[model samples]
Target: MPQSHPFARVSILCKTYDPESGFNESHAEVIELHDDQPEAVDAVLKYIYTFEYDNIVRTGKDKTRPQFHLRVYRVAHKYQIPKLQHKACTGLDRACRKITLQTSGSKNGSSSEELFELIKLITEHKQYDHSFNTTSIYLVQRYLSPLMRLKTFNE
Candidate 1:
């Protein structure tokens, strides 16, 4: 199929896929050629969601996986978005507290109940405000480990 978007310059010097080594064999074939923005986005999303860094590490200690690019991650740190960072911190704190409570609860006590209590504490504390959309809230909660460490607003 022909790509619908204009071709954009890609910075990759060279790439190779070795399925026996566990890299996505499919992406290996086409990644060397320059691609359009949409194609690049699609490819990156697929790789980030599915590619396992551990698997690549085992393949070769020197070569890192194509999953989350180190360069991109560095850029994120350089131009760090404050609001998102705050949300991330709050989410992490809540997650750590929840995990601790869950682990320390008595063997006879219910894990579900403990989780519910933690949820209650978070809600009562108003860590998330009324303005938070469902998707953003979900993302913050789901990635609580990383997000909770951020300096988020009290509400």
Candidate 2:
């Protein structure tokens, strides 16, 4: 039997342009990433890197074809939820440790630790992405004030 396909947990659809024809086009590819663990740091780059659009177009393969794009969307649609689950698991581990330490001892049972955990989890709903800005919101707001707005009236 044929070997099962190696799957990608994250994907990007690429639309490139043909300078000569002044036309834009689409294609897709599977991205293998290098990282410490599942969904950590978002190792998969964009999908445009893998295809040979110019070469294929020049060779007339695309000119005679109405559907030159590959069937990568199906794979992307399949694995997207799993990739998100992986990212959530990774972020939760970090946030949970912080919450645990921040709440080491609490007589009232409701503490800063609990608040922080709630905030971390609620904030995590914003996709828990692995971008530089995602990791360093303070740096972005401090250095590039115009790039962001204060989420609350306090600051």
Candidate 3:
């Protein structure tokens, strides 16, 4: 682990090759986190241990899948894991693609409607995700904006 990386500074004995376990003899070697979403937390752990998170989360045409990536992005931001944050953003964008998206709030809605909801979600979370200004959000906007224009023309 690189000393400059914030995550490298974390003292996880089993993971970091430290001689000390960090846990007292009576305490279990479990790490506790406060997030309510177990699946997202599991994805985070998978990424940490294996450096691959995409395969673990099989959204499988699920319309609400963007929320999973958002959860991962939030955790990454809180932990200052930039690469994971980027990956989560990529996942969100991929899920919201014109090919995969369903209506945002309804099963019978069109792809354009789903895309609209995704854009709304991105704007709503602009404050929490600092990278929105510098990276993926702009890419999302560039990719989706033209489609939005076309959608208006078609309607």
Best by lDDT: 3
lDDT ranking of the models: 3, 1, 2
Clashes of 2: 0
TM-score of each: 0.20, 0.24, 0.54
How many residue-pair clashes does candidate 1 contain?
A: 13
lDDT of each: 0.34, 0.31, 0.61
Q: Is 2 or 3 the stronger prediction by TM-score?
A: 3
| Runs off by more than 4 Å, candidate 3 | 1-9, 12-32, 59-64, 99-120, 128-155
Q: Give the Cα RMSD of candidate 2.
A: 17.9
> All predictions: root-mean-square deviation over Cα?
15.3, 17.9, 7.1
For candidate 3, lDDT tens digit of each residue in 66-147?
7678778877777667777888877776754533434467665446555555555666667876544443455345556545
- The candidate with the higher TM-score, 1 or 2, is 2
Candidate 1 or 3, higher TM-score? 3
Candidates sorted by TM-score, best first = 3, 2, 1
